[model samples]
Target: MRIIKWVVRLLVLLAVIFVGGAFLLPKETSVARTVTMNAAPEVIFPYIANLRANQSWSPWLDRDPDIQLAFNDVPEGVGAAMSWQSEHPQVGSGNMIIIEAQDPRRLVTALDFGEMGTATAYFNLVAAEGGTAVTWGFTSDNGNNPMFRWMGLMMDGWVGPDYEQGLNNLKKLVEGA
Candidate 1:
């Protein structure tokens, strides 16, 4: 009985630590990765800023090939939405809207990770030494979710690799374009 009581206490302590860590963790997360493409910003920006052309290069598409994808209120620019549904556990689900954009230059998005709420993501195209320098970044305001705030430590663990891989994939696709 004493051993069981001690085990229960330890488990309770762990849960409390996790919950408290969440609030103490940073409330925002951002991941940035850069890629250079042989194509000009005019050529590359439209592909990403347009969203319609994303599948051709998006790393997420490669992760879940059969994931159901659709577009609504689709236009070539801002206020456009792309929503995806997939059973793949790694991919989960989400919707992204091009909230603001400047053609052939910058694109910003509102990404909602479902239970996690919404966050801001942006893309920038700069004239690089060889081609266009493209940077992909995601910044999320975690709001008051103490649990999510604690997750900030793992934010890079969860998001950075994808950003890097996505940028690499984008580089390959655009350079070939």
Candidate 2:
């Protein structure tokens, strides 16, 4: 009976620690990757501003070959959106809508990952030594959810590689064109 009481106490303590630790974590997290492409921002802006054009270099598409994508009638610039569904768990259902589009400079989108929550993604294009330096970034607010706060700690590790690959793919596509 005494041992069982100690075990219960230990479990309670662990639960408190886990929840408390989450409160101390940052309420938001972000991940970004940049790559220089041998093209001007104007040449790269269209590809990112248009949802349909993104399909050509999206890293997630390669993960789920059969993923279904639906795009809005006006598929470029602000208000354009795309929703995707996939059987692959990693490539789960999500919708992204362009909220801000500044030609040849920046594009911002709001992404809804259904139950997984929502995030903001942006692409910034700036002139570089050779061409345009493109930066792709994602940011999410973990809010007050303990689980999400904890998950925020791993967001960079989880999303960084995808951003890198996507940028590499974009570089190849733009440079090769």
| Predicted model with the maximum TM-score | 2
Query: For model 1, what is the error of residue 4's alpha carbon versus the real structure, in angstroms, after optimal superposition?
Result: 4.0
Tens-place lDDT digits, model 2, residues 10-105: 999999999999999999999999999999998899989999999889989999889999998886999999999999987999999999999989
TM-score of 2: 0.98
TM-score of 1: 0.88
In the order shown, what is each candidate's alpha-carbon RMSD? 1.9, 0.9
User: For this target, which candidate reaches the highest lDDT against the unseen true structure?
Assistant: 2
Compute the lDDT of residue 146 as modeled in candidate 1: 76
Instruction: Report the CA-based lDDT of candidate 1 relative to the real structure.
Output: 0.83
Cα shift from native, residue 128, model 1 (Å): 2.2
State residue 84's C-alpha deviation in candidate 2, in Å: 0.6
- Give candidate 2 misplaced runs (Cα > 4 Å): none
lDDT of 1 by residue, 3-111 (tens): 9999999999999898777777777877787878888998888788777788777767777888988898767678899889888876878999998889888999999
